[model samples]
Target: MESTTALDPATALEPATALESATALEPATALESATAPESTRTTESSTRATVHRPAGPVAPTDAAAVALRPLAGRAVRLDPDGFLGRWQRRNATETLPHCVTNLERDGALDNLRHAARGERQRFSGKWFADSDVYKTLEAAAWWLGHADDGRLTELLDEVADVLAAAQREDGYLNSWFQLMDPEHRWMNLAVGHELYCAGHLLQAAVAAIRGGVGPRLVEVATRLADLLVDRFGGDGRLGICGHPEIETALVEFFRCTGNRAYLELAAGMVELRGRGWLAEHSVDTGLGGSSFGAAYYLDHMPVREAGAATGHAVRQLYLEAGVVDVAVETGDRSLLAASERIWEDLFATKTYLTGAHGSRHRDESIGDRYELPPDRAYAETCAAIASFQWNWRLLLATGRARYADELERVLYNAIAASTAVDGRHFFYSNPLQLRVDHDGTEEDAARRQAWYKCACCPPNLARLLASLDAYLASSGPDGIQLHLYSAATIATWIGDSPVELRVDTEYPWRGRIAVAVASTAAAGSWELALRVPGWCDRTPTVTVNDEPMDAEASDGYLRLRRAWREGDTVVLDLPMPARLVTPHPHLDAVRGSVAITRGPLVYCLEQVDLPDGVRLDDLRVDPAAAPIPVAIAGLLDVPVGVVAHGFVEPDGEQALYDTRERPPHARRPIDVLTIPYFRWANREPGAMRVWLPTA
Candidate 1:
C-alpha cells in the first residue's frame, strides 16, 4: 500500500473496480478535486428497492410510510408495529421527523419559492444545486406537504437524470465517492463521506417517495444502502461506518420494505464491534481507552463493550442509536448498562442547562467530564436532538425517569431552538452565552447551504425534525408512561389492548397533572407510571381520583400498580424552584462555575457580558455568592454577580508589555444576565462559558 514514485494501479483506470488500485491515484487526485462533483445521482432500473413506483409516479407512492408525517411535513419511515420500534414515540406523533426544516423562515411557507430560487442561484453545478433544492424539497415535502410544488418534482427529476448520466456502470453513486481516486471504493471509512451521504439519500428518498419519486432515485438509494450492507456486514470485508447514521437508516429501511436482509445487515454491521478491523484499514487511531481516539467509539461499543462517548457529537449519537439496536435485539444487560454509564456520566457533569453537550467548538466532540465551560459549548442542534433520541431509548429500555427528564429538556430547549419561526433557519451550535459577531463555528447559518466542509448537521437536523412524530409513542406491555405532560391525545398499543391516553395539564407551570386513561382490561392489575424530574417541587404529592394516595417514587418513576376504571383520573404535582448547582469537587472548570437552575433550565456567563471580551479562564468569585432571578421584559432574567471592573492599559494593543498585564485599569460594576446556553440562540454568535469564577 506504500507509494513512492509510481502511480498506484487503482487510480490509473478511468473507472476503478477495486481498493488496491486506487490508493496511489488518490494522492494525485486530492489536489484536483478539492471540490467534488454534485452528489445528485440516479441508477438503472435494476437497482432493487421495496418501494416499487411506476417509473414516472412522482407523488406519495406508498401511502402508509408517507401517511404519518410530522407537523413539519414530509413522509418518514417510523412505525411501532415493526422491529426496531421507536422508543421515543412521543417525539414523532405526526411523522418520523429529522432535524432539518425551514429553520430560516420567519415561520411561513410562502417564502420558500423565493428562498429556494434565491439559494439555487448561489450553487455552482447542477448536482450541488439539486441537493440544495433536494433539501428544500425535503422540507417542502414535510412542512408544505399539501402545497403543490410541481416545480420541486421537476427539479428532482432533472437531478436524477444528471445522476443517471454521471454514475459509472460499476454502481458507485457518491458525488465525492471516487472524486479523486475513483478506485478507492470501500476504503477509508474515516473522512470519506459516502455512507453519511447514503443516510441523507435514505431520508431524501422517503420525502421523494412521499412527494412522488421517479423510480430511478429510489433504486439509486436502495442499491447504495444494499451495497453498504454487503460490504460492511460482519461476513463482508467492509466494516461499520466511521459515522453512525447508516445503522439507524438501515434499521428504518428494514421496516419500510420488510427486508430481513437489511435487518440482518444491521446486526452484522453492529456485530463487528471491538475488532479493530475498520480502523485498521483506514487512517483511524484504532481503539482507545478514551472515546476520542476511536471514531466515536464505533471501534468498541454495545456492538462491543459498552463504553463512554469520546469523539464527535454526531458519531456518538449515531453509535448510541446503534447500541440501542443491539440492546433491544439481544436483551444484553451489558449494552444497556453501557448506555446507562454514558448517560450518568454526562448528566452528572457535562450537560448544560440547555441540555447541550460537547465543549470544543473546533471538533464538536465531548471534552473531559465536567469540563463544560459555557463559553466553549459546541452543543450542535442535531447533537441535542440525537442525544434526546438516545435518551428516549434508554428510558424505554430501563424505564428510568432521568432519561425521559433529560430528553424533555433537550427537546424543549436545544432541539426546539434549532428551528426558526418560519421553520427554515436553524441554529447549528446551541451555546450557553451570547456573543456580538457572526462566527466561524459550526451550525450558525439559519437556512440550508449548498455545502460546508462538515455538512452532517443540516440534513441530520432536517431528518430529525421531519420525523418528529415517530418519537412520541407509548410502548412496553405493562402500560404507557406519560413522560411528557402535553395536552394531546396519543393512541398506541400496550399489548393487544389499544390504549388511548389523554393528558390535560400545563407542565413546567403547575406541576399538577391529570392523566385520563381509556382502556378495558377486565379490572386486571397493571402498572402505569409517570416520570418525576429531579426538579420536582418538595416531594411531589399525587392522588388517584382526587383522593390522597401513597404513590411513592422509586428510581425517578412514580409506579402505580392498582386496578382502575377507564375514566379514572390521576393528578400529580411537581414544584419548580430557582436553585443553584455546583460542580463536582474534583472538576476544575465548574468548581468556581456555579450554574443557576430553575426546573431543568441551566444558566451561565457570557464573555459579551464581560468587558473587553474577557477570556473566560477561571474566575475568583466567592463560592457563597448567590444569583437572583429577576423579572425582565416579561421573562425570568437571572441577575448574576456583576463583572468585576477592570480597565485596559494605554498599550492594551501591544503584544507584549514590560510591566503588569495591561494599563490604566479601572474597576467597573457590570450587570450580567444569565440563561441556559441553549437559549442563547439567533444572535451574532461566538464562544460562551458555563462555569463562572468564584471570588
Candidate 2:
C-alpha cells in the first residue's frame, strides 16, 4: 500500500494554494526591482502577476526573457509508483528524517538554541554548521507544501521560532559567529562563509514563503538581507565570498518579494568576481578551500573573460548558476554567453561518462583539460547536485534540449548514485572506478556511510529530492513542454485557458511515452511540445490518437498543434538500445575504454557480478558484440541488467614493465554482466569500474 504521506495534489496539503496567504509576509520595499532598464524591468509585481507562487527555486520574474517558464510547484506532481516518485518517497520517509536526527545529533540545532539564549560557549562542528539546518528547513518547507506530516511541520515551526530568537537586532544570525566570534563578524570574507550561510537562510525563507509556510522565518531572513544590503550593497563593502551560493539565492529572494535591492546586490557580487577580491587573504585549508590561487575560489579572472571551467567544481558550477540567474533577470546577454562557453568547454573535456565532475581529490577541484582519471575521480556528490542546479537554470534561460540532456544524465547516474538503496547512507565523493586493491578505509572510499563530518551532501540531496517534481515539465504561451518523462499529472494555464496532461511511461528502461490530454478549457488552437532526447540516435515515432503524424523536431522539441483536446493521447516511442560510448581522444586515462549506456543510465561492472577470481582489471569487453538487456530484481523493479561479451586477459603479474612481446596464454571467454552505475556498491563493497577496456 502507498504510504499515507504520499504526495497527492488533491490533498489540502498542496501549497500552491497557500501562496495567497504567504504573500502577506512579504515586506514592502522601494528598491528597484531589478538592474534592467525601466523598459525591461522584470519585477515580480509587474511581470509575474498571474503566477500564484514562484516556480520552484529558480523562478525568473520576467517570463518574456526566457524561452520556457517553469510550472508552479503546486501545478505538477509525480505518481507515487514512478521511478522519481519512489525516490522522492524514500527521501521523505528515510532521508529527510535521518538529516533531522543527525542535525540534532551533530550539534547543529543546539548551536542555534545556545545562540538564542545568548550563552557564550565554544562553537560545535564546522564553521558552516548552520547551513545544514537551513538546508533541511528548506527541504521541510517544500515537503510540507506538497504533503502534510506532523513531525516535519512541527520541526519547521520550531526551527523558525529558534531562528527568530537567535537573530540579533540588526539582523545578523550566524550561530558560530554569535557563539564563538561575534567581534570578528564579516572580517574573513574569503573563508568565513558568512555570506554563504546568509544565502542558505534566505533560500529557506523563500521556500517557506512560497511553500505556504509561516511568516516568522521570512521576517527573520528579511532583516538579515536588509543588513547585508546595508553592509555590502552598492555604496558599501566591495567584496565577494569564497563561495558562490549567495548570488542565486538573492535573486530568488528578489522574486519572492518585490525588493530590487536583492537582485542588484546579487548582480554586483557576480560582477565583483575575477577581480582579485580575495587575493590578499591567506589560503584557508578548509573543506572546499584550496591553495591553487584565486581561481579555486572563482576570483582568478572576470567571470565574462574566463574561457573554460576552472577551480573547485562546486564553486565553479554554483557561480555559473548565479551568473545565469543574473543574466536572465537583468537582460545581460554577455553573462549568459560567457556561461555557455564554459559549459561547452566543461562537457567537451572535463565531464566524466557518468555526468560527474571534479577530477582531483587533493583540493576537490576540476583538473586541467583532458586530465580525467577514473580511479582517482573526485566527483563530489555536492558537485553533481551543483551541476544539476546549473543545468536547470541554463535550461530555463535558453530552452535548449542539451541542458535538459545533461540534467537527466546527472540525475540518473551521479546524483542518484550518491544515496544508497535504503536512502539512509550517502556517498560524499563518487568515483567512476574503485580499484580491487583499494582498502576502503577513507571517507571517499567505495562505501556509503550513515553520516559524515562534512555532511553537506546528505542535506543537499534531501532538498533536491524534496522539490524534484518542479523540474519535470515547463509551460509557455503556446502550451507545455515535457522535459523529463515519468508518470505524472501536469495542470497549468496557457493564456486564458487551463491545460492538463497525464504522462505515462517507464522512461530510461522502456521508452514508450503516452501523453493523454485529460482536459482543456479552450477548444481553440494550442500546441504540446515533447522533447526528443539527445541520446536517441534512432528517429522517434510519434502518433496522435494512434494516427501517425510526421513532423520534424525543431531545437530538439516535437510540437503538435491542435484545435481541440479531450481524451486525446499522444504516444512517443524512443528506442532503448544498449550502446558503447567512448571518451574523447584526448582523455588519456581512459583512452582505450568505453562505457555502456542505455537511455540515460550509465552501466558499470562490479566485482560481485563477476565469477570467482575474475578481476575487473583483467577483463576487456568486445565492442563488436552489442550489449543485451536482461531482467533484474535487485535495485529497481522496472530497470534491467545489461549483458556484454568479453574475454579475460592473460596474467601479466610477472613485471611492472615488460618488453614488447605477445603472450602465448589463451584468453578466457566470458559473459560480462553490467548493472546501472547508480545501483553499484549497494550489495557489497568491492571493485567497480564504469569504463571497461574495449577490444
lDDT tens readout by residue for model 1, 485-518? 5544444433444444455554433355666664
**CA deviation > 4 Å runs, candidate 1:** 1-171, 178-181, 203-219, 233-236, 283-303, 331-333, 336-353, 417-424, 434-453, 494-496, 517-526, 561-567, 604-677, 681-695
List ranges where model 2 is wrong by over 4 Å. 1-54, 281-290, 634-638, 660-662
Q: What is the C-alpha RMSD of each candidate to the true structure, in Å?
A: 17.0, 7.6
Model 1's lDDT to the true fold? 0.51
Candidate 2: tens digits of C-alpha lDDT, residues 515-565: 887777775888888998889888888999999988468888899988757
How far in Å is the alpha carbon of 420 misplaced in model 1? 4.9
Alpha-carbon TM-score of each model against the true structure: 0.67, 0.91
What are the clashing pairs of model 2? 32-260, 274-301
Question: Which candidate has the top score in lDDT?
Answer: 2
